[model samples]
Target: MNTIAEHIADFLKEYPPFDNLTFQELSDIATNIRVINLEKHAVLFQINDLLHDSFYVVASGVINLTTIADAEETIINKCHEGDIFGLRPFFAKNNYMMTAKAREESIIYAIPIAVFRPFVANNSDVLNFLLENFAINSRHAKDNVNSNGKLISDTAFYVDQQSEMQYIQSLAYNNSPLTTESNSIIKDVAILMTESMVDNIVICEKNNPIGIVTNADLSSKIATGRYPITETIDKIMSSPVVTVIENVSLAEAQLLMLKNNVTHLCVTKDGTSKSAVKGIISEHDLIVAQASNPGVLIKEIKRSQLPKDLKQIRDRLSDLIQNSIQKNIPISHISNIASEINLAIIKRAVELSILDLGSPPARFAWLSIGSQGRKEQLLLTDQDSILIFEDVAPEKYREVKDYFLRLAKRTTSILEKVGYEYCPNGHMGSNMLWCKSLTDWTKQYNSWMNTPGENSNDLSSIFFDYEIVFGEPKIEEVIENVIFKNAVNNTLFFDFLGNDALKRNSPLSFFKKFIVEEEGPHKTKFDIKTRALMPLIDAARLLILNANIKGIKNTYLRFKQLAITDSKNAEIYLSCAEAFLTLSKFRTVEGLKNDDSGQYINLREMSKTDKEKLKNALTPMKDLEELIKSKFQLTQFS
Candidate 1:
């Protein structure tokens, strides 16, 4: 009973855009498509050829896209099975800009614009896919054309109108939300969730929503041996639930979720949490609303069992980042999503490493230091990690330490396989110096706090930002408490840290020109990390340490917290937070473009607008450095 059109429709249903379409709709589209076979080296289209009435999707084999330059063919990209090409010309209604030829014997399904245009006009997901493809292809063509090389305005290639319109539309949510009381036992709650066939439940107090618990919370908090089934639900529930009004647009809801880093949004009578719960919108709801997207990337990361699979997910993550940036989404939102994905990848790596090495010999915690600990690692960078195991007796110490060292090596290898490079300075957990017992780590922190020197300062800056990536969190809490207690009373250490914070001079010169490296391989390039971000980072660490604040590792978050605690200097700290976000975004975009760490930036390559933005972002760095100098009384010491 399966006709060729029906067969093709079934295959199309497996991929996106088409996957979002109904079976009937896909069958209709399949009827309009023409299946064409080509031998190797067969030309599908050529440069400057008149626009075809149809666009092609490779059903099998490969298609090579190349441009003719200087009378030579320069390959731009290769389109494999299920990959769509020739869509750009149709969207632009222009002649072919590149030559498409069969790289191998190929079969492509050519769908006419008359048939596809209707679907694109009706389905926002389809339109978004096409627009994204157009943006990517156009950017590639521009880069290839300018390969002889000059910087083109990146702003010109970003497509926002269609995506923005889609985002502003009303979102669909479950009007009748399942709920439970805060006093309910975890076992009862689980039974209720099973009976209702729900993955999440809102905990209410007198018909007012107060918290939420998802299957993830149950698995991580209960099944992990951290809590008992008879424990009260409130113990594991996320408090002060994020909420939205019934009439909120999808974009607004998404922004709220991203801002709060939550997956569930309780739809209330009003927008505030005090209002009665009316409905619920979860990340799964958004996934169904917007086809395979960043949320899907998270799902994929969690599902992946192999390191290579995470690499593929990460590659898709880059595209997601590009699409988000081009759509002009807030940089913080993008960073939050990226950080979640990064953490998920690391978590999975640790899980797999545990399987490889068996269970830990003792309770230990894994710490991600540096940018990752700050939750701002947007690009693939060298890994900086440490391992801390529970203290043991003298005879047991060697056995426990050796077991953790092997585990750390396996974990780091898995992460490296997943694209996180090994630390260049031997800062990873595999090193004996970083992998230590709890007592040893506490002693180490005390030593650094008491003896403030160049080496200690360097270690402080790197180690202080640490966040537990995996394992027993209480171990990290104990270590952090020790560090905080020591740091608060160490005036001499503050002076040393303040001097280190002031090491990077202001990024701007007297005439307001950027003070860039004038010599060496990085001539005229700005080191945004050192000259701009680090001063703010160091200042935040020192000021927060002085305030005896612990567990706030992120620079921007530390500033935000500092603003709330230190009202007089709130304005300066808030400005620094904004500047840090701007600089982080700039670095991420630059890294994506050049395929390298976005540390040093060539001002000559940046557009005028970007240069101006960078200059403005740097203004807060000097003010922050001055605040640090005055607070710690460091002017006389350095």
Candidate 2:
């Protein structure tokens, strides 16, 4: 009943660039499109050929873009369905730089550049998309220049220009530095440092810095009996202070420090000690200015006293994650650094919360469940936690529980203020169900594992991956021992969990295309968390529990351990580990871009390279599901 142009319009509207255009615009563009079908190994455009009047969008099959040099073809990139190619030459008005050929029997829709030019000029989003594509492809072409016979992965070629830009920006320094008279005695300077709460002070003469004294100087000189406390401060100070202009870049300041073999540099209006001292730049200051450095964030977290202070630090951490992803750093490495910072924040929150609620009545362990528990949390999501206290007397049970509930409430509130949203399902430690005594927690785990059902399986999945964020280490050990003892021998419970693991089917359809949401608010989008990540997580958890493994809570680590223990399926387990890392990296990048939970991914927004990478990562998931079905004997239950 519909014309071919209308059908093409329907499909085009589902993807970006066209998706950014209005319905009428899309219909007009579709009306002018010429659909061409090519056989396998057919050429679409050749190198050095005059540019065609139109560019192409692959509607089906794959196309390989390559260059012929030294009489051989070098593949630069592969374009799959919904991907655009040969667009750059149209814009540059130059001959085709590379040849585009159909890798398989394919159908492509060629749209005249003149018809698309209006949208590019009018729609900012469309223009940006085209520009980004051009920049990325240009970088790829440059990288392939020296690859004589080999292909370089895109991940290996991305350079971190952001860090270089930061290095060139003006460095920030401490303006109001502590100072003392040059003739002051060493003992007097020590007292001044104590009163001002400063580790270092500048020696001033007529409002100009002549030398500097630091805690290290005091320790190595005065405290070691090399100099007397009664000696003048200048006698112990490092004279002839190294100075740099206040406007110098961070890289320049660092170079000055290294060249002089000093840890501190005085900043002056001019680049010499003759000018007035405006500020002081220390090695520590340089470290802090590089906000993306995890070490700097950790130190800041430790020094923070208020919730607002931690909120600022968390905001900076988001920048760090973005920079790390841009540099193509390994996701596992990034997650570990982020997890450490997250733990530090929670620990600081607990310390401050105790001050608010008076001291705790008894010792209790704080557990971080869900993503934070597995050490995979990159962006802040909902807070899933539990509170376990040491057993109390029957008469004192109510009093103890009441005290911990107030403590949990204060801590969760502080964390929420610091950017971790409270769990939508009320699974936080503040909830009575999750806040319990040691004996009670043990009983909870036993009951959940022994009884196999929908509710128990749901609870088990959330609670089982927990790691202690605060309190006595032994409390965590005891709880984990209880879980392994109960779960290792529970056959019925394994079946329940295995069935739950397979609840979300593989993300690919019968034709090996993505099985995106068909309708509702998430139409044409994929739930990466539930479809790709959770299934892998659930599968790993079940496998680790069956093996009676303890102390490894992270999903990737669990798979690695499974591979080590069961060599029969080691290959599949290892592949799943790699797949999990890649998928997590993708989700984090998307989340950072949209400022959301990174749960729903719009397939239309992704580049062809990213889509292909995602599909490759998800391929192992189907194999993993098949393995679970055969190993757990889940065939009978479902």
Candidate 3:
């Protein structure tokens, strides 16, 4: 007695987009669906086929999506029951880039795009799901595309619905916002605004927003005697309205607003004022879309008075990282956000310390070294920082040194309380050896560069990536100039750095098995940081320093720039960057899972897919190591 549509609706309801819809809506869509049954090896669609009016959902059995290159078919993904495919029509107007065939006897439900697009446009969750998956798939595909033109589709294998990466997620702004001509009377605009219930209106000239007038503008300029109510709207409007493109994320919008010191952002056709006005985003919109955005956390960090208050905010960062990883965000973007939050916490800690110690005797800068310096410290880690105060007179040296040391102690102590552990090697601002005047810091670098030794090389690895987190940047600039001068054409120092880099054994063995720790607490566990990540980091630093590249500190970024500077070995450098990002993501995920630093991984516990992914990520390390060996002439060192 069951209707076919009802039976189809019941099956479709178990999946997403459909699951998010009401049963009635699902049933309605089912009525328009065309159910097709196929025998094993039967093709549903082929590459270069014209766009279909409907996309598919596997109702039963398996569908293998593939692409052909060099006359060989490569399986891109396997879509099982409840899986969706052929979604290219939803996003693009092009013909199919892939072919979908039945791996076994299969039943597919083809849902009309006309019926599905409304749900996508109206529902945020459904739209986010599709966009997130498609974007992730496209990104990974792009990254893995080979010279032979075969596109690898690893990310398309799974759909993750765990957490919304709202910070990076495209904002949903008011597209049909109220607008008024700049020549319009202020009184007329006010009445039109009162009826429309909008707090602000874009003042336009030929559909392009020239300015914006908000409630504040009306109150400050018009409400006051400065501008009469009868005056033109342009008389009170804020000129050259801050604008963002349609795809601007909540975090970006917040930063743009903060940077420009405006409460609203005008969304334009081309991200400029010259383009057509598309929409507007107010601070209220950002607050509503808030899901652990860096801007919000940064505001909290600056406002926090006590270290404990900052700790509470710091603790929330792990969750942000977890969600971002779940959402498969690029590691670079995730690290940048984490770094901003980390810097803000450090800056705030310094502010609180300054408050406690009153005013400083001399100008000083707080330098973050190591992972924090490179802006890649995603998880809570050691505080590796140095304090460089301005050089003072010989008579005032003790007094100035004493003041900065006290300041360093106070700031580092606060950071420790906020969860960044004290550097075990004493590479901290609080350490008297690290906390020095600008002159001493310069002399220290010169000594290390002139005489390359074990201790100096170890220190070089950590300190060379130094970036100023707080205080006078001029102090850091002086130190940077000194380093670049000493670093240029310093073959001996680069060889030492290279020798340090090649110290770690390859992550894989002769049989391509993971070379894990053989003994101790981490026995049988793979050291991801030491074996996989450090080699890339070390190689990048050595090459960047050798190439005399300045300012780029992040390992992947260093490699990317090196690709440009050393085009002869560009492929190897690019692959190293890709591998580093993949490995970092694995480590971050493992760390988040185990609630630790994620340096070591228990290979036995990993899934087959995860192990394969990790293995694929490690493939470039061999090439990177060889490049270092030849470039640094490590054969002579050996």
Candidate 4:
């Protein structure tokens, strides 16, 4: 049999703070621990009780941490196995603010605060872990105080889960950056860059960054003999350096780098070239900041050469989605991150296909349509896309078309091998009907717009949401211009789309119960996609199209933009955005649990709170549908 101290040490080793300690350190602390057993309903500490000499770790059973409010007891949180409670003594001298009572027969370990204080004071990791836990739980308690048993808000969960990610936090950059004078010789500046083990050096004049020179500049300018080695650094430096303020976030920094197509950014006091340089942020710094899974996965996807390699990275994305949900990271954030990785995978897949098929016969743009295009695809679903190539000579059309068809076939095949299912309805670029020359695509859109009906409306809805995943931007731009010009004043098409938006009535029945499939494969299961999500998506698309809003594809974003442009119905638009996020998150969670599309939900198994949330989310639909009907004059059109 293990000694009491050994068993205590083993259990404590499984949890944080204690988990960071060595076994000997744990045993040393465990030796002085007190084990207490209590029956159900026993109170370990009540509100306003004097601070205990010890904090606690639940060994077995459950502890209810609660407070009395509004003349009634409100449970703030439940502390189960390996959960720590009664931590007030370590941080505060005041009496306990909440009461800890045994929810059932329980065993607890009370580690004397005197022994734990040493670890808190000495170990940064242990200190940070406790502080994070304490802050997260305290925030939860505050949110629960007004929640009335509702789950914690997404914002709160995001703070708790991503508190460590520091994506939005001010970047921790090198305060002392390497700099050189414009008068310095190229060879000397190059020597300085090499000696400092840095790739880039900023050229400063009067302590202000005027330009930057990187190793690429040296290789191209000096090594290539385009400029003499003795030339002034100014001759080779890239002028008008990209600048950002000290408080820029990791996300913002990465965006600036990508947008400017540069690897380094000059951090200045006032975010302009005239300001004094405070530091420099390189691509390396951003990579180190995101040294977590998402960054690593994106890097792997870009470097991956084979379909199987891409498939493994895609599988890791599922785990990332699951963990993000559990951490309560908002679905919008999760979807954005996942969508970026997915786009990279597709882009890389296209590159690999080109390696096999050689160069394209004509300039082309690969368009991702539907959910992936909307940047809302969380679950693995069918790839819906179209290929638009530049207009070719009529005589050479057959040869060019054949080449692109072969390319699309190879690319889609690789995508399938990477886990994206092929569209069953032949909506992919591999289909000749969907892939066409830019001029032909423009003609097709005009055909659909002039002839409004169920078929044309369905095709327009899918085709209008296309976002270019790769290739020539001009091809996609020409089609977009054609769409806006023809679609802006197209009343008949709007009416048809408005009617289609109302196709699924409401997700709820006359009695306000969820409408479920009565028969078929998903018998008695709610179709959230058709009912809850589609209504909002369709409404946003119709309204935005009518308003001539360009370049906004995501449904929630379309609604957000509508809120700005159509202020009269701003309240309804904002509510729809929130509702869409909540419903999308709900569906994503259900999908993750069952490993399938989160479309049809088994309402019978839903918890009371989830049902209430769903019902509340759907409430906005009535207002949105009314807004669409009023805006489109659907009654007269019908």
Instruction: Write the residue-wise lDDT of candidate 1 on 72-130 in tens digits.
Output: 77776667677677764443334777778998999999988777666765676775555
Please provide, for model 2 over 120-173, each residue's C-alpha lDDT reduced to its tens digit, 9 standing for 90 to 100.
Answer: 756768765654343242234544343221222221112222223233335567
Question: Per-residue lDDT of 1-638 in model 4, one digit per residue for the tens?
Answer: 24989999998888776878899989989899999998999999888899889888888988887777677887767777877778666544458777889999999999997787777656767765654454342334543342221212111122133322233334567788899899999989888889998888899999999999999999988899999999899999998899988876554565456445678999999999998999999888876765444556667787899999999988877876776676565677677777877898999988898889899999999999989889989998889889999999999999999988888888899999988999988889899988889888898888777777735634647777878999999988898888889887788888888887888657998899988898999999999998899888888888888999889999999999999999999999999999999999989988988988899888889999999999999998888877888887889533
TM-score of each: 0.56, 0.58, 0.59, 0.57
Off by over 4 Å in 1: 1-291, 454-460
- Global CA lDDT computed for model 4: 0.80
Cα RMSD, each candidate: 28.9, 23.0, 20.0, 24.4
Query: Where does the lowest 10-residue lDDT sum fall in candidate 2?
Result: 148-157
Order of the predicted models by lDDT, top scorer first: 3, 4, 2, 1
Worst 10 residues of 1 by lDDT: 148-157
**Rank order (by TM-score, best first):** 3, 2, 4, 1
Task: Mark the regions of model 2 whose C-alpha exceeds 4 Å error after superposition.
Answer: 1-292, 454-460, 636-638
1-638 per-residue lDDT for model 3 (tens digits): 23999999998877776778889888888889999999999998888889788888888887777877579887766777787778766544458777888999999889998887777646767766665555333322334332221222222222221112344555667898889898899999999989999999998898898999998998899778898899999988999899888877654565456445689999999988888999999988876766454556777888999999999989888877776676567888788778878999999999999999899988999999999899989988789999999988999999888888898999999999999999899898888999999999998898788688745634657888888989999998898899899988888888788888988887899999999887899999999999999888888888888888889899989999999999999999898899889999989988888888899998889999999999998998778878888877788544
